[model samples]
Target: MHKASSDTLRVSVVVPVYNRPSELRELLAALVLQSVDSAEFEVLICDDGSTVDLRAVVDEFNTMNSLQIHYFRQHNQGPGIARNLGLHNAGGAIVAFTDSDCIPEPEWLSELIGPIETSSVGMTGGLVDFRTADHLSGRCVNYLMSSMLGAGGARDPRAALHMRYYPRAGNTAVRRELACAAGGFSGQRHGEDIEFSNRILQMRTKIEFVPTAVVVHNEKKNSRQVAMEAFQKGTARIRLAREQGVHELIHTLPALLVVGLTASALTGLFLPAFSKIAGIPTVLYAIVLALIGLHGGFLLKDVRALLLLPFYASLMHIGYGAGYLYAFLTDPSTSVSLERQTVAAKSPHDGMSEQ
Candidate 1:
């Protein structure tokens, strides 16, 4: 994923911003200096109804004439809908997406679009590295949900997905046509990217990995934020699980609980080696249980925060469980609706269209 700055690439950068004022400002600053030719690119910044005044944030980038940058304000409809609106307003054949909290490398867009142009792939995604340990837990949870959420994963998690790739909605690109054809992000608050990726994979669309298209996800060091994030993520996971018809996520808790209890009970009666091994997972399981018991209300993913690795994973399981229960009781059907209006294309489907 070498940078392609020689030729001008017209990219419609879509960023969905919320209340994060300072971060958004930093992101805009980074966008201002991208290795891609600013003159050839356009930016559509959708304000996802921030409670705070973000005018200054947008103002920092809006005054620039080097690139066409515009701002749209929408009531909080969650990030999915916010991004979908940006998708509708984009003007470049190549649509690049990133979160407001993310800081893109100078070559971010160039590298992402470069591979897609060369390979003629319909869409692509990139890797996200957290900035600090204060975000380790939330960051780790992001890793766990990556595969299930269509955010892209290492051939193995142990592989760390560090090898360069694409498919994640955040920090990724799509052929404007492909996004338009499949419909845009669902209005749901969560798992919209998962649904979109599943649609692409189901269609056997060619998606490539551009390892060089990297972004630093400045993860939340705040537990409350992490907790709320977890809750929302839980809500989304449940919705997506039903959508995918995968019910195992819903039952993971009871099953894990049973495993924990059974392992605890059986450990004392088993031979030494077997007993220790049985106790290990059980001990880890109990650690998760204890964390939730102690700080179930908190949200940050850092060590001092409420969600630890095992506990955060467990909380996610709980959220999915509760989400599944609610969905099953409400709508048992996970069928995709044909009525889903395809996202109206604001630009040509250069990257997503068949060459």
Candidate 2:
């Protein structure tokens, strides 16, 4: 990588962190090892009201590395708000965003920023690969996440480019000015990335998907964790669908299936004549489950993993279905007010404070 002049900071990598210190440390270490010149970029660690002060970690990195590191803190709002804070404080022309849990490849920064610099594209997103660990549950989470069904086609390069699929904030980089002009990010807990990307697209800004700029997401989610994430995502989907369009419902297929199957079963339970009819949805659900297992097994190429696929898939579907239903039934005003209440309860800190 060519080194930039001391006076010019070409890229600013912004990471919004919560309470995952170990993961944040790993991500920082990965950033320090980027092929780009240390002088060409800076890292901004935005702490979203983590209970523990992450200053020690930032201090440790600053002391050991020549790369410039900055830290800021805010009361627990969400990653979206924390990121907006980082963007406001960033000095670089290019703003790169990644999660605290992701470890970018050595060439990630260069590849992600290259398109925006060389082409008319205002934004670029990299590929995210799940890291496999020794733990079975973790591997299960990885398989589920990387699978096409699990990601709802967002990770697929073809779909991303042609299907209007938006990139996740964790692996995207944007031209700082365009990002700011697009009104930055919203305070939504989930789907904020999609909402932000949609805004950018509305401006006719080119957003490219760079497959070479890869990041390994070390997500260690157990079965329960996976279900909880699915649930949260489902609820977020309802909001997105309301704002974007009914097309957003494509991402909520599993949840819809769950709702359909459950309603069918409940109907049969209430009416004895429809008891046999209930078996129709049950069979359909079973077939879907089988397909999920097959898809997961095909991706992992591990027969043993199939044993747990059913349980994990069921939890994912059921949890998401419940959340989606709740969101669908709830009043939009009520939900928005609740979110505002949560944000209002947390006071915002002033300016950036380096740890």
Candidate 3:
């Protein structure tokens, strides 16, 4: 751990990392290129018990740069807990957060802190998008969970359909005092940022959305990884509901989709007489999914990715629905294994919509 003397820093960039040394290096390089002066902010890297010695990366970067950087390590806790460690040691009035895998734009820090500095808002969340849309699987997955499909809340304030707009830990800035007073992060393996934002909202603290403050996530997920991430996200939603009573009918849409598809298939095979009527929902769903895929493909400018979108979305929906149903069936208090699954899935704080 490298402890630097605290100065009158204006912003503290808190980044929680785990087993991503290369990504951390990239983030550090990007931070050095920020429009905000190096003297105006500091970067704190909180390690979440990775097998690799991440300190070496931080030290190597520090030797060549003038950025004020501090490193902290803890046991294998979730990103939420690791972020709490950063928040506790933050030396600035404003605490900005971004994942190690994200490469923030030059104006990211400036844009994020600008609103909070000028307005009375307690926190602000910026935009998170893909570093690249070249990969077919990754692009399809992004489309499936994006605002275009009404399944995500990371890009815009109106993106969220199932949950209230909340700042994600990956690209958010909060007043140091207000975040600490709200009790920091909840230490959950997933959805901890949303829970934290919920607490901030309970305090009636306004959270603004800054579209220009952007971070490009270096996403490199395979088909399996995409499906597994969706599954973990679904399970995490249930956990949030159990703990916070945060429920929305839209959250159950995937599960209902699973059930409805299953029924339709079974009915078509076993009871051929009503197969046409039973298949109506399936046909309609396919049309909607196709339209979404077409739109995604147009935006990505990739025909191959568009064709693969439907299959990718099916995997996403099915996996998420299954996980949701599984978690919903299991008791929350005794769902130790489910929580472990979340960590195993390496679920990061997802982007939420603006309030």
Candidate 4:
């Protein structure tokens, strides 16, 4: 709550990435250009298991940079593992995180670190923007892609509750001590951010979202690959819910809604040709499909995106719901022990009701 100096170099930027060489290059470039003082912080690019060699990019960046950027290559562990490694190596007072596909604004570090300047704070996240690319197809894709985001637009009315305005891994930061105290990230499957925050919350540390600290995210979508990612995200989200110990209903609720909506949409898609013509319900289904499609349509372009909206929605819902079911069946409540700390809960779905 106290205003702190924005130019402080107390923040450490941690970026966990996979085999996206191009995206990694883009993000590294962004890191070098940060407005925060180069001397105050260090950049850790933890490569999970890049298929291609990245030393070229790092070598090129170090040639003219004042910031000390270190590259760590680990076995093909998930992002969770990579981030944990970054946390272990980071020396900054504050820890900031972003993904390889995102471009943080010059003020990102300053803005994110500003709030955590208070001693009581533990974590903070910033606004994540799904900006449009210059191509016309890209514009359509952006709008369609982000349409499902009325969910993102819905801010927590409770100012005391941690903000989900931009609850994304690509644009979040946490204090190093708090993160270490909470158990450094590797406890989850997909939603490392959610799981990481859970440990912080358990420690009674304050986590906040600052909309002003923005990052322009490059939403990756090849026209042909949209449906597959949609399905994978759904599945990943369910696995994420289990990882964070968030109730399946709470974590997988969006997927459920999509399923319900998709069934209704499919019914409408099929009814248009029926003799009885269940016109009203079909129209209602159309409305639902259009609404949900608005989200995907903006994410994609042409007929494939539009034609596959219901399919993608179904894939996401079914995929996530199934994953949650599987995790629930196998390890309803699992613990991830690290060092002396153990991140586990018996029910994993209890608590937070009173929150």
Q: What is the TM-score of each candidate against the true structure?
A: 0.71, 0.85, 0.88, 0.71
- Give lDDT for model 4: 0.60
How far off is model 1, as Cα RMSD? 8.0
- Model 1 Cα lDDT, one tens digit per residue, 109-177: 889888767776878877665423224654555544443221223211324332222266677888777
Q: Candidate 2 vs candidate 4: which has greater TM-score?
A: 2
Best by lDDT, which number? 3
Q: Which stretches of candidate 1 lie over 4 Å from their true place?
A: 1-9, 131-166, 221-235, 244-281, 284-314, 317-341, 346-355
Strongest candidate by TM-score: 3
* Model 4 regions lying over 4 Å from their true place: 1-9, 133-166, 187-189, 222-245, 248-285, 292-355
lDDT of each: 0.62, 0.76, 0.77, 0.60
RMSD in angstroms, all models? 8.0, 4.7, 6.5, 8.9
Native-to-model Cα distance after best TM-score fit, residue 209 in candidate 1, in Å: 2.6
1 or 2, greater by lDDT: 2
**Model 3 score (lDDT):** 0.77
Candidate that beats the other on lDDT, 2 or 3, i.e. the better one:
3
Candidate 3's error at 338, in angstroms?
A: 13
- The digit string of per-residue lDDT tens for model 2 on 2-110 reads 1244257888899999988988889889998999988889888999999986878988898897877888888998999898878876768888999998889899999
